[model samples]
Target chain A: MADTLNPPGQVPVTVLTGYLGAGKTTLLNRILSENHGRKYAVVINEFGELGVDNDLVVDTDEEVFEMNNGCICCTVRGDLIRIVNGLMKRRDKFDGIIIETTGLANPAPVAQTFFVDDTVKEKTRLDAIITVVDAKHLPQRLIDSAEAEEQIAFADVIVLNKVDLVSPDELAEVEAQIRRINKYAKIHHATKGNVSITELLDQGAFDLNRVLVHAPDFLTSDEHEHNDEIRSMSFEAEQPIDAERFNAWIGALLAEKGGDMLRTKGILSYEGDDRRFAFQAVHMMADGDFIGPWKDGEKRVSRIVFIGRNLNRPQLRRGFESCQVA
Target chain B: MSETADKVLQTRGKTRELDAFVVKASFDRSGSACAFALGDGEVAILRQGADDWQRIRAHEGAVLALATDAAPQGWISGGDDGRFYRIQPDGTVALIAPFGMRWVENVTSFTDGARTRLVACSAGKKLAVFNAQDEELKVFEHPSTVTGMVFDGKGKRVAASHYDGASVWLVASRSDTPRRLEWKGSHIGITMSPDGDNVVTSMQENSLHGWRLSDNQHMRMTGYPSKTQALSFTRSGKWLASSGADSVVLWPFFGGGPMGKPPTELAGGDGINCTYVACHPKDDLVAAGFADGLVVIADIASARILPVAGPGRGPISTLAWSPDGAHLALGSESGFAAMVDLSKK
Candidate 1:
């Protein structure tokens, strides 16, 4: 009953995306149930271009036709901006916002909507993007749908979800593959859609200025063909990783077979301070710098995701573990 | 055809276009005939046996099919949407009936004695009959999506074809007791002979058929390696012609007429778009409308190309010369109609 971070005029917009049947809605419902009277405006999707039985598929008791709680469920109708703007008119009633886009819905235009639309951007800031992945079906889905690959590429926080469904071997394979596609995204291994709310919001992954400075793109002027089998695996090492040995291993891997690596990223573990350092790589081109210390009093563990083709997980694990401060 | 392998490519005309917007099956001082294009969204009167052009923007949503009588008043066209409009030579447009649907698949006319009527069907799934006077004669329903439709000789009966099956119905009554011709094949082109006694159908699959409406007796004309795109009955019903797999296969009635010849082998022959081939009602002038917007009028005896000039910026949708044999009208996919003065060029 107190005016919190989201007061009358300063609520942030968070985008939710994942592959089809990837537990996005389940996680959202859990959040809503856990934090009810907290008052967050919600955007839910209906059918999209790829649905066979394309009809409205949301199960909220709230009458969407006369929606008044800042909650807007837009069906296949192209009235997204209209619905969101209506909610913004009564902004005093809500705390923040969450947009549940369709599984295959491309998030670029959704992200751009925050900057492009004149009315809503004035009232709210884009907060964070949380993507859920079906741990069991991701491997096959990545091969079948282009939307899946893009979902991984644009993730801010990827929930490697549905861990209960995948076997131990399959879970390991899925985690390694996720890291290969996105190096900077914070990965959270989740089961039954369980994750800490503190971890979900305000991590500042949506801060474009901060990201560009810490990670430099080597192939900025050149076109890079994607290595089909190589995947990017990214992690954040809370402590310093042995930069000399890790660089040697990455250099040797690229020298003999850089074409086999699609991408890789991590926060380097420095030799002394128990603080996270960051890095990103695209194929053989790699450049990174230490941004700032990870927030003190936070869990001091390194987090990273590697994304590339034919990623050597055994060698990468051994190589990363070998970089521990001795 | 079992499957529709239609490759529609956009093309250009030399000066303008070779096409028709609305084709009415109409009547004039000439006789019982069909008008192909519309004028100012009105009527384009084409008599059965004359070559002159009549300007009559006489309908709404453009003309689809025209009818004719000795006065040449018998004709109908199921419009672009779903409304079926009828046109009289005096430039009078009447709404015969509305199918209350989405797409008007086809509206073709055939003469039955002195009382000629037009056959109109829309949404490719509903059928109806309107007389020369715009009278609603009968209406029927088709089982599946309609691909091709035609009225048999005399206009006493109709033949409807779909992606699954084909049927023949008597026009006298809105009868569903159609002689269920067992040849259940996906058809691309369907036609009733001038006498409306036999139905000729073409498929995208690999063969063409001739079913005798009398008892469903039929003939299978073979040889196409790919798909048969066009099929038609010669004016006299003495010859049956088909083009698919890039070759013209003419099946002569009785036993034999001529062994089919490839289009490339025609005298002065070049590759043709081969959209629809229409045989002249009066003579042996066979005009094949192509995707290149070229209407090649081939004299079967010479096997040569006689390019009839017309209008279009794309492929010809359907091409038909005035029944009187005066002006040739070419219909294009771009929704414009082109009329070529046969005597002009």
Candidate 2:
């Protein structure tokens, strides 16, 4: 019976995902070898990939299992649940945990595990989902593998590695393709995975309060050709939303189409309320809260983003518009 | 209740600060000594009236699992350093098996007749069984990593629970196949009744799954708010006490099993979860340790609870009753170890 009011401190967990030959091993080695002054217990699919050695390295079998609750999209990494539990027993030995998934891993199950397992949720926080992409081959990967597209769609930070191998124009094209699939991820250009450790760790990217931080060019209007079936759609409404209607509409939408929705996020200004509402979801599992009251004179605009496959822009727009307070 | 618990700790309890997370504590069969496996890779042994515990560095890493050795005088421990060891009462350690880099997740031992003793330890997907002569008898493989292992009452069979099911194998049989009890989810821990008629597992989900060996009948126990990490059966094998909910949930195992009856809840409703439970060796009493560091012993006949220790520091990680049912040894994750002499009460 951990005291809910004053629970123990949670260790941050970072999940590293990438395609084959994307220089993930390079980044992992840097994290482990550099004098960052942080002790991280790394959980990798195999040992000996990194040239640098760590004191606490654990091997995991990417064992995924469906939940018994009948939710088709609520699959979780069973191995992670076990490993995290074991690691927490030795919590004093490490500062953080880093999990490196296999190239073919579905990031959804790994992400969903932090939400579904009670022990994991209480002991560790999902810091961020960092996906490494090959700048020279991302365009081809997007076309050839659905996993590649899904990885981009679920990332909070995209490491655009191997920028030196591709032409300037080709790099811009690859960046645009990544943006089309995921507009919220912060894109970092690096060669040989030489990104700053600060940018990748402790991002708090999954925190509801950090959701919907729109960049200057985040809402840029574009009518680009479709290169992949997966894409991102964003919506903004100036009028305050009826909370009840919006809840009903979003509930029904997620229930029917959550399998197609990889990730969703929003910050809303509800009718007759001064506080801001933050919402996020992975498939059908949704979480939300009133983060805080609006700043002194800030504009109370509501914004939402959905990264998924086969999105119906017009139908979603209509459903959103109908929730506005009339 | 809090005042009474404090008085009990002050009058009848002897406390020790081990300066490490206490993983598991058990008493030897003769009730002469108790051993505690610690996170700092050491095993501490305290005899019945010893003023201080003797510490032995048994492994190079945290001792993940510990059990009283089948030999009447020592303890067996498994460590994250991938080694299994036997610790003598006099602070001597012996390496029993070396698993290189894989963790020795669990260990259990049982004595058969007068001379034959069996020791079993699981490392990942393989379970290695050794005999009294320290000879590797057999290696059992499971479909997935074995989370829990236990021997039946007769020590002729052992059940290993893993993902999806629990497999019961005859300890001495040469056959590769075992009697499988199939379920759908991950089974994290397992226990068997003394009568050997039931095999129960604590699932990764907040529930318990049990199977009657007679027909492989499934008895699903649901509605636990958290994962049931601890489960124990009374001496008569009539009730199964578990930790998961706010209370000590005791499921009746005598009247046609706990298949359709409601479990009796005790010493709870305070918004605190019970983390570990140990039943008295010869009585219907059960000692339950809470997540808030409270220990309460409940009487089954009168439905009364006597608080044995007050809440503080950290959650209780292990609890065990001495063979004579007169002493209770408990430890918390914050290194608090206490031996309570309940015989005087």
Candidate 3:
């Protein structure tokens, strides 16, 4: 059977999320008004956020529904599935799609919709989750709202807008806080949401090939303050991992603590295997495959990162270390 | 592929290559004409013997829904342009309701004696009902955006599927409360058994959920490989034919309502997923369209399969049987459409 009902090529969908007044609307206006020489169907949560002159702007309700498959964290955006299906009928009219989520919404359901729906998965690829943060008020928002922390934790690209509002010391502190929550996101500083559209769209951030490329220091063990409810933890092992042991350990770990683990990504070198195994997870759902053969003369290092709440760093490290071949 | 089926398409079929995706095709009540609603906001109508299709620019955007209008002998269509329109056989389009920004997602009509009632739902919670004269009768509110709507056999009650469940309402009832059949999932499509005893909904999940209206008993039909997008009740209401699995998944609706019985799969096993299914209006046969663009007719009793047209250009998107069961109309996502005159065979 064909894996997708769609034709060969899949349209890329970039999810835009941020707290209210974090320059999300400004960024959207810029994307729509700028002569990017591309047609994009933008799905926004509010209708009058900006006077966007684009012909394909769609207002959507943030209707989230838990899947009937008994996985609690496997919720999906019902409205988005409907809108995306409708937009696909006019697939030729748009080069790509961008979804602007509500400020207070959880980005997990929006991200999981691309993973859960077979039709959505086949028709559109989740290019990246771009989260915009107000550099001035992010510290207060992170302290008050869990959604703020989550938007940062789940982001593949973070646009620190309103950078001029904060001092250099304050900016560094805010960036540190963001790093403590999500170590791998590509952070771009912007003023008035004036970042290049290239950084936002078609990043292929979810692609396994680009997974570790964004995090150059992915394999390095860096010390950072981990005081927040949601923080990042990483582990590196020099020895090649046992495929069976690694699968069992990761599977059980995700099953038990996946809800608390907002995002998990790893590139591993398995013992006696020529190809590197790339693994990714959004809550309880996980996907992995042997991406390609390891490059010649490259060090065989297996690294994993988990960004979530109440992460038992020591326990997770022991579990991953135990997967190493004797 | 059967030779007879191949011959049917070769000799009796009228094919057209359109400019945009064919969203839906429907035969009129007289079975003398069929109209195809396209993604390019146009309606193409072909008379029983016409060599060319009379095209009408019906809406400003893609037509999202289309259904046969019985009393007027035309078609009622709703489009993303937010307009409800009626297209006559002469290629004249009349605007019925203009909902400025909301996409009219579904449209249906039913006749009672001489009056034709038009029903349409937009992207939100309202389902509007209008009379044959194009005057609004009543507006029914749903808990969420109405995804699918169908009138019962008697035309007295209308059932709408939306998020979390389906709702059945008495059309003329002054009371605002509808009989809500609660299910905890997104119900994207709905169908009513010919006898109006069962209301089944195709869910966002890869399964179908149904309710026996008399006692509110739940009937869960699972195990589909993909989401069931098309559903049809056999003429006698004995079987509910659905597309999603490799074969036509026919769940028995007559024998105590398919609660414990396994479905009888037909015309598949070749691993090609069926994308659409249309039951014969007057017989125990089903025409199924597959992902590989193959169309086949399967007899429920004999399990005999006959190929019709494809392996065309794209997966079949829509299928409709003439009210007389003499003609079958089908279209694919790649804009290939055909009407097969089974009557001559």
Candidate 4:
């Protein structure tokens, strides 16, 4: 079969997010000016504008189409669909795109835009969400705004910028705090928002490997637990799940509780099949694909990660555990 | 002669997989060639070379929209690759312009004798108007991303549909402010009535909204089961046809307007939604493609339905009738394309 469902050639989009004054612009300037030969179309809001003195990079304003759904997420989604769809129409425009969100903006709406819109879903892939964190002030900022924690939870890569301002022990404590909020993200330390541009771009942060590595023991047990409302949980099984049942359960689960799910991802071992089923969901929108078969001597395990507020871990665990083949 | 033309009827001819999941199809002025916007970011030109249609693959990514140009007698296509291209009947492709990674969501062409203009919109909420020589004429900034665009009768003005409403701009004039027509929801697809009396937009809320140009009277055409993606006005401007449900909904544009009167349904039922609709250029006939990939032509006067093509690879995304009404071209989401001769022998 020629695979009727052929994935269209999609442009990769990387989102830059952090609270106000977290060195996001400094990092953005570095990424743009760094001798990385790749050309990028940077999408940035003008309110918290970067004082980018470099003539090397130019930032332009883009109005995200507003959706009248009475939901913040849907509103962001409408603009993204139009903007992304519009950007995809031109040829040789850029190798990739970078979107810088407002300081107070929630990354969920921006990330969910990729998954929900049919046009955006077809033409652009969400590469990664890089959240720049102010190491010295994160503790106070976390208490000041929920968006601070939301950014931490949704980020695939957390740039702990301004590390020079914090003591070594304080840096370690901040790292530990971020881990407690989001155990899946890869953390990097930076002083002036200066980090490896290569490492940040094309990171495939949402790929199967990262999801598998972070949540392997998630289903087995919980350690380094946090009492915060926003947390991560895992569900795993050694045996394969009934594909139909699993899909039905997940579909209903997302339909009912998707708003509370900041992020959800999983790799499953299907019943009677060697092909591994890897899937991920940003809120309600979910995408799954069949990866390669299980390697020799590799454990046949399925694992899932959910990061969000008021996550009913016990209910989700029980529901996922019930999906195993009888 | 009428009977002969009617007997010639609608018949499927020459199905090709030159590309995949066609989003739009267009036929040039003479009907000698047809162009298809493939979902895989490629434009396939089927030229009438010698005996049969020869396929030519035209772009690098999924072609989002396609427009037919009459003067140069070719087709223009915009793709996800952020490039606009003009493909001639001879299969020669020219890069019209590039939008630097912005998806050219829509491309529309207007021609007045030797004067030609190509207007395209990109992701940054900007509209770039170009002359025939591909020179930038004017760039219009919008409050939101544009959803759809349509040209007026004289090809002098263009209306762009967006989040809140639509904007009507006189492309031929500079310093003329585009007449902004406001409504409340996100408008997806837009069309101007043939007589230029009103503008109607397909809303995201599974309904249709319209505004009379003369008085800006807001007209609501609601009660649809799905979002109306395609809209067409009859040649006489008596009816406006839309695709949203199993049947083609024809709103009467006669009398005072489509407000007080009820809409007439045609060529539908069987649980298959009409995915696209195209009115014949010179007749009261309309061709509608169903979600099942079936294409049928219906005469509004006689209420007769003739199956043009069907059981296709996927849902029909686009249907275009040549300017002279000599041929009808249809393309589906699964890369299936066919051109049917509609003229009398």
Better of 1 and 4 by lDDT: 4
**TM-score for model 4?**
0.69
Error of 3 at B315 (Å): 1.0
DockQ in order: 0.02, 0.45, 0.58, 0.14
Candidate 3 lDDT over residue span A81-161, tens digit each: 888887777778889998888899889999888778888888887778999999999999998999999999999899999
**lDDT tens digits, residue span B1-345, model 4:** 233232323343656764466778887766777877776566667765433555556656557778876355788777656677777767678887887755677878777555555645444467777776777787877777667888887777788888789899888686758899998767888999887878999987678999999887988898777768799998888889999988999998888869888888998778888989999998988999888877888999889988776554577888999888878888876678877776665
lDDT tens digits, residue span A1-326, model 1: 21122224556767789987888877776666675456676666434323222111221111112111121221111123333533443344557777777887655445544433334445665567788999999999988886787677667788889898989999999987876566556788898689877677655543332443344333322223344643444333334567787777767765555434433445554676554455544344444455455566755455444555565555665666666666
Clash pairs, candidate 2, are none
Residue A319 accuracy (lDDT) in model 1: 63
lDDT of 3 by residue, B1-345 (tens): 445545767888998888778899999777779999998888889899888988889877688899987454788898877888888867789888887667788988887646545555555678888876888877888878898998998788889999889999988889978999999989999999998989999998889999999888999999999999999999989999999999999999876859889999998888999999999998999999999888989999999987887585589999999998989999988888889988853
Q: Per-residue lDDT for A186-256 in model 4, tens only? A: 88899998799876888765455555564454344533433556787777777788899899999998877
User: Among these predicted structures, which one has the highest TM-score?
Assistant: 3
Interface RMSD (C-alpha) of each candidate? Answer: 21.1, 1.5, 1.2, 5.4
Candidate 2 Cα misplacement greater than 4 A, ranges: A1-8, A47-52, A207-211, A214-228, A237-247, A268-278, A289-302, A318-326
Worst 10 residues of 2 chain B by lDDT: B1-10
Candidate 4, residue B315: how far the Cα is off, in Å: 2.7
Instruction: Write the residue-wise lDDT of candidate 2 on B286-345 in tens digits.
Output: 999999999999997788998889998489999999989999999999899988888864
